[model samples]
Target: MDDASDDLPGVMRVVRGHLTETYADLIDVGDLDRRPPQVRDLSFLSRALAAQAVRILTECSAPEAAAAVTDGEGDHGIDAIAVSPNGSDIWFVQAKWSDRGRAVLGEDGALKLVAGLRRLANRHYDGVNVKINRQLTRIDEALSSPRCTVHLVAALAGGGEVTFQAEQRLTRVGQEFGFDGRTPVKVHTLGLADFHTFARLHAAPGPVQITATLTQGWHTVHTPYLAFAGSVPAGEAAAWFEAHGPHLLAPALRNTRSDRIDQAIVEQLVEEPENFWYYSNGVTLMCDSVQAQFFGRRLQGEPARLELGNARLINGARTLAAVAHAVAQHPATAEQALVPLRVICVDNAPEGFLSQLSAMPQSDSHTDLLDQVAADPQQLRIREEFAAELGKQYVFKRGAPPPAPSAGCTVQEAALALACAHRDVSLSAHTSAGLEHLFRPSPAGAYNRLFGQTPPGRQIWAVVQAHRLVQNALADIARTESPWRREVMDHGDLLISHLAFQSIGLEDIEDWVHSAQQDPDWAKQWTGDIVRSLAAAVTDRYGQSVFLASVFTDASKCRVLAEIVSRASATGNQESTANTVAPARRRRNSISVLVDHGRIPDGTRLIYRPGSPPEEAAIGDWLHENPRRYLATWVNDRQRPLIWEADQQAYSPTGLIMHIWREAGWGEAPVAVQGPARWFLPGEGTLADLAGELVRAAALDGGA
Candidate 1:
């Protein structure tokens, strides 16, 4: 539905239209056929809504999202389940699509959701129907991981909260699963506004074809392909992005960035249009062919009119998106900007040249490293092995789109898995510091240590899956640990993965798969105890004051920490260490000190990031439904420090945060919060982090 369709009938009409058009083939019809004919469409609509929720929350492609639906009879109230590609997120959706735009999760629905949660949590897949049963193995593995967070998505068609009774039931569920920090179950009530946002994001646009004027144009003739270099008006470039959206980019390059544009690039364009041409890297376009119309003879005198055939912005997609947003927001200022343009005709290009052009711009060390690894004879063999044995796509190219998580993985992902699986904990520790460090060009570097033996494709995939499970399990336990202990658990993800690999003894990589199938809980069962012991052991050895980043980055330090963990686990003395880690000493509040010292620049824009996971879960959906909700500007005043963009009201940071929480319907939110910690300067850390630096600097100077 368009923005103008605000009435109940229009929204419902849109929803109904989608049932037949977008989801007719995808949604399961078996159960709908059994329902009364009058209610069948409504039932389908509800199932469609569940799939939509999966798409929006997990950011999966439509077919994948639709496949997540398990809304037939005996589904236990869960309509769909979607796990993120990285295995960090898991979602369970229960949708209610109402014709009157007044859908509500009533007591019955709430009870059903609760029952489904319990069943899924306790591995009671035997009671679920075949649709859900088919996915029990993957679901079981996801649930067993402590790191993966579960979300209960209540996708209602109405513009209201779930009923009070339903809220109470969900609150009880939250307290049961969420309070423990392990297996945190977040509840999301996605209403009409939220659905509208998701629909907008999910809209698909066709291929883009634009007629552009290129000034001061130059062409190359001796090249294997025809190429033109010129400058295009920023306004024209912006219009292309405005019309085509991500279609402006080549298919493989789309969806690379979360935002429509990079905010920093937008700011630069808007703030310094005259400098844009100098600062920007310009855009590269690949087309089937180009027809240029030039008045008279000289390319320099008159502008050339070009029709770019099947053109795609292969590079600088973010730049074009930034220009579009900037021009929309500040037309007069952004109108002055100019963008350099390069158009290549792929029709006459030599074989393999297109892929070369695509990856040419991304030639950094990591990209180079991946290229080298991909060129290796062993990696080529592994790719074939994966195809022959596992029927998976093994992507190794730098700019190539990654396959779906279930389909396969990229070379970079494989390296990380190998790092974690190495018997030497230092490899995993080095990875925690930076992935490139593993690929450093040395004979004895982590690269040779991991891939030197040319492990089989099955082994690589198995280790990756195991590493994901270990990472998730550690995250779940870390949330409930003491502040110091939690830090170790959070940073020691790869280290724990290494420990699990050593202990599980993957003599055969398929052993992990066999064991996992036999006991899905093996990951959590084995890793949870190890992580707890490791967290305590690290703190005991290094003390709480030790810089965690430094410690994790150093191989020797991580080796010592790993030994301590292994020793503690073997001795059954995990809890023997005295809890000497103290809470951080109180200092002047960062915001107050920053304001009193006149440290922050006035008028600087601030972004509101949720201070905690719970806080994010509480209001993230609400904030996402409207962009203005999370935007604010900093001011000099200590008392009322922020000007919230939504209402243009000046409020103290905490007051603004509370106001947003209340407005978002988080009625049970705590009364007090450290709000400065939630707001951040663009490209800088949180306000608290910024202020803490100043305080630390002053202290180092003896309070001078």
Candidate 2:
């Protein structure tokens, strides 16, 4: 259905194929013996209904569930059942397709929808067939609890809108069920326009409008680059992700990011929602246009909103994943977990020609980030002209094949190789915009400084090959019997690959790539030598045990390593220059400040768990002031020991939150902290209750 079906005729073919191949087993498909000749009569309705189910499953991001068509002569008017991704909501679909426009299922169709919903709510398993019966059983089990919501859907093809009379009928039937313990269950209607809208959403999810109550601080930068900066609630961000995740950046990421969403991002969303925003880098997106509305979250349901068209996110994929993960894991926390976001839409400003800039140059701070930005319609045209002349797939996405016969190298690899070797702009601009976090992020126009150069694409491809070959080789080595292998293979493989490229024979990278490209077998022969020589140099300098860890974690080491590989080191720098840097103590020191302040010296030796939160820190400080009271609070409330170790030790706040969040059977996300929050807080909690018990115990002790 998502493939090439541009017109109704094409759609008919796909639809027929779906009915014949995908849902041939459905009872509504009609038996060959009795209705074999008339089977064509049902294909349009059946296929459309099944297609709607497929759309519903996709919109819900539930690829695991199957769609079933069950409409028949004695059938209960239910055409299909689309199982919800999380089983939170199951859609009972009633579809009607008419050959002519304006012809509709009307009130009669609406009543059928209501009847089907009733069948589901009533659990009339015996009335339906084997497949629908099983689905209804699942629905019954889901509805047994008040948590899951039910959706009564009507899909109309060229049908008139559901009339008010039909709506009233649906409302009455819905109220009769009282599924949510309140008003009539809503019947979501999908008209012709809705079908097209959903298709558009799946394609780009843009020309999108994201609205929210602008929490507190937000700013707009208009000079260097135009952008909106603010934090949206995690719940709101989750809504965006739920609506159109991979599609949000489909045009930009291309294929670099994986097909299935990132798992770690999702895990954090489910397990640690409140902290999601803080853990996120926020997202920066590039849309075709942006519209801003200031009057936000007003009375009577009016809210501040942003209306963006052709909106496709350019960056912040990790953040998007985190939001996606959270929605899937703990949807309840989405609103509370606020994620910071920065949006940089397309700068379709009036074209400022290079000559204009040269004459009255407006310096841009984000030149590096926006180097290739189509500053004006003209520049975009010029870029296109150059691309046409080049006769290359000037730009490619993440997942695009990394190699091409005519082009020699993938867009990204070729651009990166040139960026490192020749500092070329034509390709680097496009490459940097796509592979930011991969090759070290840089502002687009920033590389314009390395001008007057363009490396052959073929050479770039060979270098890319060498880079992959070396990284894979290192990974293979890690799997072998070397002692420092773990350190080398685990992290910084790409970083090593980049450094090794410079180390290969003293020839310019372009020359090596050119030779490799021309010979078709050069990299296979020379890359090994480069890798071995580079490894020997690093080992000779840093000792094999400390090789990789010592290089990647420090910048000076990486540069020194690169210098060694290229033999550009004036001394063969046996010394590794060892840019004496201070030890990494940022996190440790910050944590100390949070936990150490207001502490009264205790006679007992302190037990350190290093990364404890402020609340635990406060407790540690408070313990010195009132140890007996604190200890008593825990003892009375928990009916168990407060002290885990012999000495008073601080527990990790997150570790504690995780224990509580899980111990609660993943019931709800831990309430997010707005600002600095204490660990042993007041109000309803085991710890808080323990304090009350402690006070009572103290009073009794005094009375005694």
Q: lDDT: which candidate is best? A: 1
TM-score of each predicted structure versus truth: 0.43, 0.33
Q: In model 1, where is the ten-residue run with the lowest total lDDT?
A: 577-586
Over 372-489, each residue of candidate 1 has an lDDT whose tens digit, in order, gives 7777776787788789868988887778899998899887888888777765676776677568756643322466545543556766777777676667666666666677666667
Q: Stretches of candidate 2 above 4 Å error?
A: 1-33, 36-39, 53-66, 179-184, 196-339, 342-704
Tell me the deviation in Å of residue 286 in model 1: 3.5
Tens digits of per-residue lDDT for model 2, 253-272:
53333323444456655666
Each prediction's RMSD to truth: 21.1, 25.0
Steric clash pairs (candidate 1) = 146-473, 147-472, 147-473
